[model samples]
Target: MEMIIHLIFVFCYPANNRQKLLPKSPLGGCHSMKILAQVLSAALLLLLSTELLAGPLSEYRSPVAVVLAKDGHWLATANQTSGSVSLVDVASGQVTDELACGTHPSFLQKCLDGQHLVVTDTFGGKVRILEINDGKLLPKATIEVGFEPTGLAVSPDGQTAYVGLVATGEIAQLDLAAGKLVRKLEVGAWPRYLALSPDGSRLAVGCSGESRIAIVDVPTWEVAYTEKLSGGINIGHMQCSADGKYVYFPWMIYRSNPISRDNIRRGWVLGSRIGRVRLDDSEYREAITLDVPGTAVADPLGITMSGDEKRLIVAASGTHELLVYRRADLPWEGIGGPGDLIDPKLMRDPDLFGRIELGGRPMGIAMADDNRTVYVANYLKDNIQVVDIESREIVREIPLGPSISANQIRQGEAVFYDARHSLDQWYSCHSCHYNGGVNSKAMDTWNDGSALTMKTVLPLDNLSKTGPWTWHGWQVDLNDAMHKSFTTTMQGRRASEEEKEAILAYLNTDRFPPNPFRAKDGSLSAAAQRGKRVFESSDANCASCHSGDYFTDGKIHDVGLGADEDQYEGFNTPALVGIYRKVRFLHDARARNLEEVLTDFHSPEEVSGTRALTEEEISDLVSYLKSL
Candidate 1:
C-alpha cells in the first residue's frame, strides 16, 4: 500500500514543464491542493531572495568620517544623531559594536595602537576615548574641553594628542600617557584640522576663520610660519605627503550665514582649490583648483595621498563624491604666484577624472593597508562607504544604525524644515541652522537685504502646537511659510506638491533629543536658577515677550537693533527652545555672544525701543535662557 501511494504521488508531480495528471484518491483532491500550495511557496521564496539581494546594502544618518583599522579588517564611523561610534567587521560586513559618546560626535581619530578611538563632540564640548577589546568598544574616558572642539590629531610619536578648539581658535595638546593637558597653543581663528609633516618637525593647522595655514614648530609649539589664502577659506581637512616635500590643504568658502537665500549665490560663487605649500620655505601656491563643470564652486573635505605619492584623493564634501588627481598631471605654473595667476582653465575637473556617488555627506577619509581601497564617512547618511581605488566603485557599505530615518521624529526636524528648500540638490535645513537655528555672524548681505535674525525665524518642532511663522508673523501655517520662504524670499526653486508634502511630513514629527542641560538629578543649573529669577523679575520682564513651553508669546515687539530707522520698529518674537545653538544674537546679529545681547541692551543702536538692564541682571538672564 505504501509503494502504491508513492507511485501515485510521483504521477501527480509535474516534470520538465510537462503537465501531470491528478491521481485518484479516496479523500478526493486534497492532496493536489497541498501540492499546489507547496509550488506557490517555492515561487514566493525565489522572489523574496531576489529582493533581499537587491535592496540597499545599508543606510547612514549623518555619517561624518570613515576609517579602517585592524589591518583593514574593521570599519568604524561616527554617527551624529545617537552620539555613538559604530564598529564593523569588513569580512562579514556586520556591525560588531555601537559605542556611545558625548552629544554630536563630529570627528573621530584612531590611536596608533588601533586599540582605542577618540571622538570630538562639537556640541557637547568634550572629547571621549573608547577602547576596542576583542572587536567590541568599551567607553574608556571622557575629557571636558573648550567650546566646539572639532578636528583632532594624534602626534607622529603617539605621545601627544592635538585637539582643535574651533570656537576659541586654540589647539590643546594633551599628554597621552598622563591623559592631561600639557599645552594649549593659540593658532588662529576657527582652527580645524591638524596635519603633521612626515618628518614630525612641523605641524600644519588650517584655520577656517583666518583663511590661513599656521605651520607650528613641533618641539617649540610656536607659530613657525603662516601662509594666507585668497577668499573666505574655511579650511577643513589636510594631509601631508609622505615625502614631506609638499603639504596639501582642502578648503571651502565659509558660510557664516547659511540660511539667507542670497547665501547660495554669494557663498557658492567663490572658487575652491587644494593649496600646496612648500614646508622648506613659506611660499604658498595653488597646486590644483577643482572646478565642477557648470557649478561655481567645489567644497573639498577629506584629503589624502597614496603611499607611493603618485595619486591624491579628495572628498568633495559639497558634491558628494571622491575626487582623484594625478600628481604628475598637475601644472606647476601657479606656485608662489598670486591668486589670479593660477590659470583656471588648466584646473582639473572632478567630474572628468573620476566621481562616484556615495549618497552621503563625505567628511573624513582613510586608506586601507593596500592603498587600493578608500573609506569615506557619509556624515548625514550614518554609514561608511568603502570604495575601490582602482575601479572607483563602492565595494561595500557598512551601516551605522539602527539610525534615525528621515521619517523618524527627532528635535532637529523642526529646525531642518524651516531651513531647507524643497529643490536643493545639496544640504538640508539643519545644515545651516546647525543644531536647530543660527550661528550668529554677520555676512555681507542677505538675499533680500534684510538682516538675518533668530528672533524673526521661528522654530518648527512645535509649529503645529504654535501658530504663525517668521518674526513678522506673516504666514499663519507652517506649510505656507515653507513655501513662501523657499520660493519667494530665498529664491529657492519652487517645490512640487509631493516634495513639499514629504518635507512637511519630516518636519511635523521632529522630537527633541535628550537634553544635556539637565543635571544628574534632573535639576537645572545654578546659573539657570538665578537666570530664571531675573527673567521673571520686573526689571527684566523677559516673560512679557517669551512665554510658554515653546518660549514665545507669539507676538511682535520692537527691540530696536539696526541702523535703518524703519527696522528699529517692532518684530515678532521667535521661540527660544533651541536658542542656545545660535551664536549670534538679535535681528542684526551684531551681538558676538549671548552676553552681549542682554548686556548691550542700553545702547541706542541695540535698544532702540527697549530699555537696557544692568550687567549683573543681564548675566542672570542669559544663564536662565540657556537653561531652556
Candidate 2:
C-alpha cells in the first residue's frame, strides 16, 4: 500500500511546476465545493507526509556538486556561495552533516582510501581536505594553490592531486603526503575541470578558455593528445564510461555573438550538446550529441555514470535538474554530416530528477556504487539534495547556513530620470552585466565574426570607481553610458521619467556586497604591504596610473597593450576592487592573468608601463590587488 501510494504521488507530481487537476463533477455547486475541499485535504495530507518522509527541496540552498559515498550510506555535496559541504543519510532520508569550507568550493571527490574528502575552492584558490569519521566531516588541511583553482582530480593511486587553475591557465600538481605543490604544468586556456580515464593512464583537461581538451599522460606529465572543438563550445565538465572506451564531454555553445545592438537586445542563446570521443583513437569523430529540449540555455556543468555505466547523469545547470540518459540506446554515429550536424530525432527524453525550480542551479552530480541514489550540489542555493535514482525522487535536502539569494540582493538603484526615453521590456540592468558587472572576456559579434569589446556593451558595475567608460573610453559620464545602453544596445523605447528614476535608483545602489575579507583595522597584510611599497616605488611605479582608494586614476594612459588599429595611445585604467574574479586582464582580454597583464610587451612605441616592473614585483602587486 505504501509503495502504491508513493507511485501514485510521483505520477501525479509532474517534474515541471504544473499540477494536474481532476475533472469536476456536474453536481450542485455546494456538493462540488465539498468534493473539492475533500480532495484538497487529501492532497495536503499527502504532501505533508512526503515532506516528513523526504525532506523538502526548499531546505537545500545552491547545491553545485554531489557525490555518493560510504556504500550509499552517505551523500556529500558542495555549495558555492555558502562555502560549505553537506552529507545526507540515504536510508533515513535525513541530513547527517553540514560543514563549512573556504570560499566557493566547486568540485568534490572522495579519497581513494575513502577516509578523506577533497573540495576545490575556485574563488579562494585553495583545496580543502576533510576527514570522514563515522560519516562526519572533520577539517584536516587547507592547501593554497594557484589562482582560481576550479577543477580537482585525484590520481588513481591517490598519491597525487591535480588542480586546474582557471585564471592562470595552469595545472598545479600537489604531493598528497606533504600537502604541498610538487609542480605546475601549463595547459590550454581556461582549464576548468578534469576527467581521469578508467585505467588512470591519462587525464583529459577541459579547457573552456581555448575550447579544447588536452590529454595529459599521467606518468610522463606530457601532452598526449589534443582535441579541438567548434567555435563557441564552452567545454565545462566531463565524464568517462565505466569500460573506459568512450569519453563524453558536455559543451555550452553560445548561438550568437553578444556584441552588436541587435544581439544585445535579443539576448544570447545557450545550448548544450554531449560530444563522444573514442579514447584509443587519435583522430576526432563525433559519436553522438544530444541537445536538451525546453531549456533556454543548456549550461551543462557536471557529468557522471551509473554504477553499471548503462546511464549517463548530466547536470544541466540552466534547468537546475539531473538528466539521466540511456547510453546504449542513444544514437551515436548516424546524426549527420559536418554541415548538418545534430539530429533532432536522436534526442530523447532524459529521466529528470532533483530540484526543478528557479533557485536550484545544479552544478555537479555523482552516483552511488549500487546506482540506487544520486547527489547534486545546488550552486546558488548553497545546499545538497539527495535523490533516489531508481525511484526518480528527491528524498533529502541538506542546507548550508547564511547564504544570500538573488532576490535578496537589492538591484543597483537608478539615479536619473529621462522622460523622453523608452523603457526596455522584460530586461533589467543585471541581464548583461550579471550582478551589475560584466566579464572582461571578448565576445563574438552578432552580424559577423567581428569581435567587440565587453566594456562598451556593459558598463554598470564599477562606473563610480572608474571613469571614461567603454573600451574606447568614449562615454565620459555614467548618464552617457545609460543613454547608449537604452538607445543603441538595448534598442528599446525610451524610459519615462518615473521609470528612468526607478531604473537609475536600482543601478546606483550598491552592486558589490561588502568585501568579506576586508581588514577591520584597515591595515594591509604583510604580502600586501610589500606589494604596496613596490607599486608606489619608482621601480614599479604602478601608482602613477593606478592611484587612490579605488586603485584607479580614472584617466587614460598609454599601457602599450593594444593592437595597431586598437592603439588609442591611451586607455582608461579600470578599478582593482575585485580583480581576482576576472579571468582575463587588459582592455583586449588577451592576457590570462595579472602577471601577464603587467609584464607582456604590447608595442615598441611605449615600453615604460610594462618595463617598469619585474616578474616578482608584478606578483606582489597582484597579491595586493587581490587583497583589496
Candidate 3:
C-alpha cells in the first residue's frame, strides 16, 4: 500500500508545491503525467484484485440471509461466501451498495433503532452493527460475541440483542446502546437460532443439538421452559407469531433406522417438517410433515408468515423451492408418533398447501411490505429472487454483484447442497456436513456396514490435507468413498465420474475458520503454552500419534472409544484442528465437550494408562485444546 501510494504521488502530482518550483514529472509533461497516473491506477487495481482473488472471489455474493428494512425500501442480504452485506433497493431493483462486513456473514436483521442493522459474522464470532444512510452502510461497531455465532434476535426496543453462539451452546446478550456483550445465557447444545415474542416477554431458543426449544423469560433473563422436539435436527429460522401465541420453525428429522429401501419408502429414513411451539404452554406443540410419498421436501430452512396471517412460507434449500400453506387451514393438531404426523394424502388437498419451484439453493426468505412478494436468498444462483405469491412465480432475479463463470468447485458446492440427487429427494451431503463441517449429530451412514451404530460427523477443515477418510480409516479411495456416501448413505443415485471430480474439488477447498481463541498476533496464550507442553509430554502420549501441522499421523487406534457392534477394530486418529468448534467429541460422540473428553472417555490416563492429569492440568489442557 505504501509503495502504491508513493508511485501514485510521484506520477500523478507535481514534485514541488513550495518556492514556486515545479519539479519534473515522472513522464515529463502534464499529458504524460495523466498517462502515468492511468498506469499507476491500473497497478493499484491489480494489487487490490490480487488480494481479493486470493480469497474466494469466484463465489461472490452468495447470499445466505435476507431481511427487509423497516420502511421496506432496502433489502439487506448477508452474503456468506463473499463476506459482505449487500443492500438492494426495492423500488429500483438495483443493488445500491455492497459493504464488507466480516468473514462468513450468515445472518442479519434490522435493529430497534431502525437506522442500524445487526449482522452476525458466523465464523468470526462477532456482531457487526452498521448504520444505514441513503444507500450506503457505515460500520457503527463490531462486538466480539463467542465462537461460531450465527442466529440472532434483537429486542423490540433495539437496546438489547441476543446472538446464538452455535459451537459454544450459548446466547450472547448484547447491549446495543453500549455496543458490547452484556452476558452469555446458556441454552443447550447448538443453540443456533432465536426468536422473540411480539411483546418481548419471552425468547424462543432453537437448540438443534438437543432437539428442543428453550423459552427464556425476558424479565427474569432465564430459561422458563424447554419444549422438546424429538427426532428433530437442522432447526432453521424461528419467527414468533404476531399474537405472540406461537413460535414457528422448519427442520428435518432422521428416524435413526437402518438405511434400507423399506425404511426410505416408509418415510422413516428422513422427512421434512414445520413445527410450532405454543408460547403460553410449553407442553403444547405441533408439527406437520411437508413431505409426500414419492416427492419429498428436504432441508426446510427459513420460515415466515404473511402480514395478514393467511399464508405460511418455508424455504426448502435442499429442494430449491418454497412450500406455502394456507395458515388457517394448516393441521395444527399433528402429533408425530407411529407414522402419524406425516400424511402424504394431505399434500393432495389443494386448499392445504402448495410447493413452488425456484432455481438454485434458496436458504433465506424475506417478505415485502405488501406481504404478497418475497425475497429469497438463492445460494447457488448468486442472486436474490423476487417471487409473487399470487402467481406463485418469480417476478425477477436480482444479482447483488457481477456474476462469474461457474467452476468445478462452485458446481460441486451446488451438488453438495442439492437434494435432488438423493433418493426421494430426502437430503444432500450438506445436510450432514453443514457448510463443510460437522452437523454435531452422529447417525447411521452404513459406511462401516453396521446397523444403528451412530458415528460423529467429522469436520472437513483442510479437507485435502487430511487424507485416509472415515472413522475406521478403512476407505483408501477418495472417489470411491464419495460414491459410496452418495449411493449407500443417502440411497441416492451414483454420481458420474465428472461430478465426483467436481465434488472432490469442492471438498479440497474446505478449510478451517480462523481460531478466535488465539491472540491477535497468532501467538498461543500462557495457558495454551503450558497445555502444549503437557500434550507433547510422555505422560500424555498424545503427540506420538497426533503429530504434524494437520495434527494427525493418518493412523487408526482403539482409544477405547469404539462400539462393540463396530465392523472395524480401531477408530481413525482424527485431526485436532478446529476441535474447539465442535460441541460433541469422540468417535461415537459420547462426550459432550472438551472437558468431558479430557476427564471421562478418552482421558490421558485412560488412553495411555499413564499418570492421571490434575484438575489444573485438565483446565489448562482444555484451554490449550480450544486454542486449536
On lDDT, the candidate that comes out on top is: 3
lDDT of 3 by residue, 416-449 (tens): 8888888888788877886788775678889987
Listed in order, each prediction's TM-score against the native is 0.70, 0.66, 0.90
lDDT of candidate 2 over 31-115, digit per residue (tens):
6446645655676577577553232123334566777765777777776544567766767756555566755677888774776
Candidate-wise lDDT, in order? 0.62, 0.59, 0.81
Which of candidates 1 and 3 reaches a greater TM-score?
3
Per-residue lDDT of candidate 1, residues 1-628 (tens digit) = 2222222323333453112333455565676656645654664466357542122211334667666774788877877655567788888888776655655677787774667887887767777777888777776666777556878877766656788887667888776656566778889766768877777787888876566788888788789888876544557687887877677877644334434434454334234577777766687556454544334334567887777766778886656778766666666535443232224544545423466666556778888777668888876566777888768899987766555555433222322433234223223444333334332233332333354432322345676666666555555776776666566544557666666676565555443433445554558787788878877766666777778887788776766543453333466677777565454556555565677666665232354434576777667677677657
What is the total number of backbone clashes in candidate 1? 18
Model 1, 213: alpha-carbon shift in Å?
Answer: 5.8
- The TM-score that candidate 2 achieves is 0.66
lDDT of 1: 0.62
lDDT rank, highest first?
3, 1, 2
Ranking by TM-score: 3, 1, 2
> TM-score: which candidate is best?
3
